[model samples]
Target: MRKLRELFRLRFEAKLTTRSIAASLGIGNGTVCDYLGRARVAKLTWPLPAELDDDAALTALLFPEDAKAQAERPEPDWARVHAELKKKGVTKLLLWQEYLEAVPGGYQYSRFCERYGRWLATSSVTLRQEHRAGEKCFVDFSGDGVRVVDAVTGEVRVAKLFVAVLGASNLTYVEPVFSEDVATWVGCHVRAFEYFGGVSEVVVPDNLKAGVTRAHRYEPDLNPTYADLARHYGFAILPARPRRC
Candidate 1:
């Protein structure tokens, strides 16, 4: 077990990274992680206890749980488990508990997850994100700008592209404005709602100065004009705050 000794030395003495240790010792990354986890659980250090100086003793000490032959538990119905996971606020731990109730001899949470994960990789498609119809509209500005020419002076200006998307259908409304000032920002929302033929229950906007005057966590400040537009349409303006996304 020369690799095991070197693993301990690299971890506790040299403090090399897992990737570095794996590369240096010619072992797999998973093996390195397993060894490190066992060492931590057994309270092992670089200079192991004198009793485990021998190879056999060290292996036994590190992997006592593996030496005992445990009987296999019943496999979980992963398809049902997968379906349960899609419901809002349902977690793996909760599903595992429910599984244990149905089959008392079923696998533990860790193995249940491992087996379920493998089955999901082979059998399931990625989850679809569903938004409520007319519940919310997400609003943002496109980074790219379009050209605007004044008819009288023939002066050229770069205009910001305002964009709005209805959450359920992803219906989009776009307009090029000279600036993102309060008036233009409010006007864009008005036009967007008119184009959509209805107002969403909530209008989510980026925390720009024209919409969110202050980005405080507890109490965000919305611009008066933007707030007034929301009031007129019977919708609420919700500005995305820092660290919320």
Candidate 2:
């Protein structure tokens, strides 16, 4: 549901192309189009209604067919459940069983997890920091990919998404590449820098295999090609700490 809201934000506020949005979110282009189509049919716009903030509410409004079934089931206090999961030795399966014990007709384990995930997504928040212009650029790849098929041979391949964001402005650049090889990674960075019209002093990237051969807290090993790219661009490569989250 976070992706759903971001889909609306990317389309209405950022004004990115549908394909770009699909790539950035690592969803299919058809999926992006379908979401937009549903939004149009529902007459939903950016800064969605306060009443529609919850995933269940948004889902009910967007896909009304399942509303009755969903409403019939008793829902757990998701806020409390979310907080509890943070404690040691607590898991979703245990929580779901407890919920069922309390409410005999409540959602099953699968449904419980599904609802919890949706709620988690909608309730998630991101912290932003202020930085001097051109000071830092953060980059990462989406977890999924978009499919691309050959025109004549009909060979299908997955295109990875490369996303770069400026620290100060939160300005973003996204591109789809056939692979995450060192060359492709470096090329994407160059293009992103060009898109921003300048290079940042530091490039902070997630510990991607192509860019960082080995991730470390104090010092990370950069791929030779990636290192050369940094040298040529005169920007420092700062790989994000491994497993910090």
Candidate 3:
């Protein structure tokens, strides 16, 4: 369409008849007439803009310019934050808070997160790697069932067992429990940490009823006992999403 219009314009400027222009451009005579009609309606003159030498540039100039640029946040000192996160216990939220304090008129929470995510795209980091010794402890429920037996009454009960796997060593600890209640859930973590000999820097768990009271995709609510256990161990509890199950 654009090429036909340009060809008609050039031929008409050279004072050729509509039929002649159509023949030269290998288009229908009616197409040449339509182009001439459109040019007349648009009030396009023979002489075009000096800057618009080509058809592409002329077409661009016909349309209105885009809107002005929007305000944006400044880039953060990613190197410092990256180093800090590598240290024992550093969180993105904590770093963001500190950034706000240091730069009074800095980026908002959402923008800060957006910028951090962009940085992560080009980051030379491993998504999944062997954790250093005593680095992380991952806890979750076992898919298979475990049986709990009573010696005196000769009673047997099948229940779900909570399992904890160390990130570095792959050393796992399992405990059979009657229910997935809050008390049992919190108690299992305590025993698991003790069994590991020392508390880990981070604790990862699924969004189970016992651990998380409200399971939100963006922000989750950790049960009081769950938070308390984290404080006791000087670690953090990052709940995994339900989709992970």
Ranking by lDDT: 2, 1, 3
Instruction: Return the TM-score for each candidate structure.
Output: 0.46, 0.52, 0.45
Task: Using TM-score as the measure, name the better of candidate 2 and candidate 3.
Answer: 2
What is the TM-score (0 to 1) of candidate 1? 0.46
The runs of at least 3 residues in candidate 1 whose Cα sits more than 4 Å from the true structure, single-residue gaps closed, are 1-128, 149-154
lDDT of 3: 0.72
Backbone clash pairs for candidate 3 read: none
lDDT of 3 at 218: 71
| Stronger candidate by lDDT (1 vs 3) | 1
Which of candidates 2 and 3 is the stronger one according to lDDT? 2
Top of the candidates by TM-score: 2
User: lDDT by residue for model 1 over 100-202, one digit each (tens)?
Assistant: 9988877788977875754453342233456899999999777758888999999999999999999899999999888888988888988998899999999
Report lDDT (Cα) of residue 188, candidate 1.
Answer: 91
Off by over 4 Å in 2: 1-73, 77-128
Please provide, for model 2 over 24-103, each residue's C-alpha lDDT reduced to its tens digit, 9 standing for 90 to 100.
Answer: 67666886787788788899967898999787788887767557766787668989999999887799999888998999
